[model samples]
Target: MALGWWGRQPVAVLATAVVVSAAPILSPAAGDRLIGDTLPVEAADALDVITPVPSSLGADPDRVALGRMLFSDTRLSRRGDRACISCHDIRSNGASAVARNLTTDGTPVPRNTPTAFNAALSFRLGWAGDIPTLHDQAELALTRPEFLGGSWPRILDTVHGDPVLAALFQAAYGHAADREAVIDAINSFERSLLTPDSRFDRWLRGDVHAITQAERAGYALFRGIGCAACHQGANVGGNLFEKVGIFVTIPNRSAEVLRVPSLRNVAVTAPYFDDGGVATLPEAVRLMARAQLGRELTASQTASIVAFLGTLTGSFEGRPLTASRASGTAQPGDTP
Candidate 1:
């Protein structure tokens, strides 16, 4: 008797399911055990922050303006095709709708693009926790060969050649645009992407009518079942890193390492997880419950949590416009 297609598989799906279901509870180290120590209690106090939301960096008006332009500039990429918004779209919860977007040459990048909403609050940046600050992360992305694929000199040239960009940079930085100023401006704008006026935040701020009964119940279940341990901070999960399969490895290549993502605007950002394997919110909940909690969630529990997560969606104020090159548009030899 020959093995069928299903039988030829190395791991049984049901067995893998069992492992994911038992992993979270059985292994105490699966989630962020450092939640109590790392996330400051001050994060919960909305009034302390100047913007009424949790932020890890300071905001400067000029820097944010510069960042906004760079974020939308396609010239930042080596092939002049990709921008910060290419992967992390501000319209779609700050993440791309597809599993992954292509590089300038159309090569598929691995891993789902994480949301930029409230990303400044994360203790670490990127799916691997590789970059610590927004500025560093921006610089890495801009200079990475596989990513933007452009050198600093070329990027500076492209930006400086654009008139609209040059004017914007001048207004924002109070001088001619430079490489460091460009990076700082983008970082500042990113810092302003924090979203904290969700119904959950309102409820936490003593608004009894902010969230629905179902959402409230879901919040209780989230904490009661220990989901809150890692996903409790202002952004609701960006403050920590966690391995995907703790007690048992899920039958997937990308299961080993993952940064716990912020659940803010989770309703809009589908195809969950770093791999973008799970398609729906309910499936994401089920997968997370099984993988992180080691418990099978009831249908109602999943529904309520989904309802609560839906409240995290926020609105963006303005649309970024494409600007002209800064070089010929500005006065000669005006480089900062």
Candidate 2:
């Protein structure tokens, strides 16, 4: 295969940076334990590549509770028919399982809804990586015509009218529900959505029995093939941006450069890719390998990688995340 742009960059440079940057955040005592004589050489090597997600982001509890209620309230939408939960169903998959979701006016959303779990750990918000913070993301969703289509004034008016919501806002923010307060509450809840303690995380912390031999082999393959170059760090991929098809090409990709998505709970949040066109995890893995690494993985290699990915599924609020049955009602016209 010809060397693409990805070939020009040294994988070790980014990989080393990711590991070094994690030192201050990741527990040093735990790091010593992971690299100590207790673990196998492979497990210790894996620790230098990807650190475990932190257990908490330390968001405000009152704000988190307020955001939780506001998340489900339909009044936030222009037509009072949708909430943030409409596309991002936190109860099911943190995202819509379909490729895309329809807007309130029936227009299909341009990109797939990425999972809400562990998004706080990512560097930027959205697949484009244009939005800086969860607060901005929430604000965009609230006002964007393609999303909730509601203006701030109207949203605040509704909030002011509702005694229940107003009181909750007062308790959370110590003031009335203004634009900043509303967005801040939602952002607080989003920061609280971290999914920690996956099997892979346990393995990272030196629990040799957390994953099977086959899964460990899969992790080796995942790293050996250079997937870890971009998909490394606490979120396992969200720390940076990269083009999807560095070597080959992915058909129907809407964007070239994208924010590398977090692999946390990835097994549950499918169909894959920004378009959500890929239906299965194995297919997505194969497509990514060929496109990004310029390698056609054998069946066993694909299965092993898939198995390793399954170990990434973590608990949200003390319960395991499952694939959403009500993935999306929208068809594949322009939505998934």
Candidate 3:
């Protein structure tokens, strides 16, 4: 019997059933052959595991606009120095380039900052999957001294003090600024940050030419080797909590159980894993295969998987997301 990624969760058994049952069967024999490295999967089968990102998650336009302004508003921070965009740069990959972000005193934070793009799609908030909602996450960030560090009274006063923000809040919420309304507006903007229409999504939607042969094969390997057990669904990995190093021991400083990250814009959001120790996409693929699946993949196999992951990069504002030129490519022999 195949145990799930999390020993107690039985995710593999249940998720595999969901995947198999959701797809329409054109030919039972054909589906068998598609699991290997040659043929493309039937579109019907692909939709069962990974669905396309919707253009919108139905956020109110006024809330989104107000939230967009607040996302960059430094007054949200106690020092009036940092903003949400300081770390989650919407202009780039929606994450910090460094392995971790610095606190007010310039000491590094414990974990790598995950991208803000498509974050609302995750079943839970934060790396540990502890926070229940986007509102809670925002509240934590606002109050945590090492993070935004603003007190509730001070934050409310700061917001009400600014004429522009006060007017925007009045227009959006029909009242003066409050903690809940501020967090709610920020959540609305974050929900609007979904990156959709990736090449892989197009392929899943029946555009055969959207992805290359190698990518299709890599996707086959991805599922065949059990990456999909934890990384399936519309956001491609955020729907479940799984422990790292299920097969091999990978070091982690935080809780062993982590919310699987979304692969929506993963190619561009480099410096991967919770620690951000892995530098390249290829390296991350190789490491995860050994750590999670107990498989030591060859260099070519890693490349194919990397190519497939590249297709997961999605568009924001009709423009394709990109990363730094020297983010580093996968080198052979790098393992967990």
Candidate 4:
């Protein structure tokens, strides 16, 4: 246990932690420990690292369909080559998967583009926790010169020119191409981007076969070493701000603190962190362990934890959220 310096009662927490950290009691065919390790009710109640996705996020079909078109319409950009789809593409796990998204002119954006999947579940929006809602974030992104570089007039002009899109908006909101209706439609579509039914979630719901023994061990270690303090709640994070290097210094950005990201779909959202500085799961595991927890994990341990993270990959619209992992995903020890 990493409880020594953290003001925890070593003997008490460790004893219970041991039972909670152990492997299943028997073989799966025999149905013993079918749902894996059993923790004390108290211990279980104290943690919030895992939460099941809401079965229904309450999306309006009309708004979603209209938002789908708006999300892809490049005319929303000043350059006509960018749109909401440029960075937060639904086909790519709602992230562009780049170190930093760039403008049409190739200038770099300020920070990594977060995935839109499950974003509505987040308590606050943006890496800085600056934006309050998905609707507001969409508006800022649309108008910001650094992002979509669009104004209401320029975008409304484009929307008014498109008879099909204009009619769709009119039908959905009793009017054509207004700022409020536009953002509302986009927000509705984003609400439907929740990726549910991950293996971890299935395990949470009492399925024994959802994850492997090593993955379970990794989860135990994750709690034992205290990685879940900030990364808790339904989203698994996106609840608060966290310093990047609480235990160790990260050069160039050691002093900056930002909002913690939700790890629900982390296995597929590669090029991690605010700057997208890390590339592989294994590498990120090692660095975060050292920097955040003051722990140095072995490759075997890292692999196990990373394996647990893989079970976080969930499905969207009845398919894998991202197309990049269609062939296969990077294993624990594979190259980035």
TM-scores of the models, in the order given: 0.75, 0.85, 0.85, 0.82
Candidate 2 lDDT tens digits, 1-336: 001112234355476655543332434344343221223335435445777878777788988888887777778788888887777777766787677888778878888888878888777778888887777788888999888889988899999999999999988778899999998888888888877889999988989899997887777667666677678767777777888788887885543898888787889988888888899999999999999878898888799889999999888888878887664632211211
lDDT of 3 by residue, 1-336 (tens): 001122344356356645643333334454455544432354424534677887888889999988888888777787878777777777677776778877756678788888888887777767777877787888887888767788899889988998988998999888998888999898888888878899999988889899987788778667655677777667777767778778888765433888888887888888898778988888898888888878898898788778888899998888888772232221112110
State residue 114's C-alpha deviation in candidate 1, in Å: 0.6
How does each model score on lDDT?
0.62, 0.76, 0.74, 0.70
Cα-lDDT of candidate 2: 0.76
Supply every candidate's count of residue pairs whose N, Cα or C atoms clash at under 3 angstroms. 15, 1, 0, 0
lDDT of 1 by residue, 1-336 (tens): 011122232234234333322322432233433211222222222211111244334588667767777877777778776677766666446766666656656776776777777777666777887776777888877988656777888888887899988888888778887878887887788887766566666666678798776665555555555566566445566555578876555656546665667677788777677777777999988777788767778787789778867766655553321111211121212211
Candidate 4 pairs with clashing backbones: none
Candidate 4's C-alpha lDDT? 0.70
Better of 1 and 4 by TM-score: 4
Whose lDDT is greatest here?
2
Candidate 2 error regions (>4 Å): 1-47, 253-255, 327-336
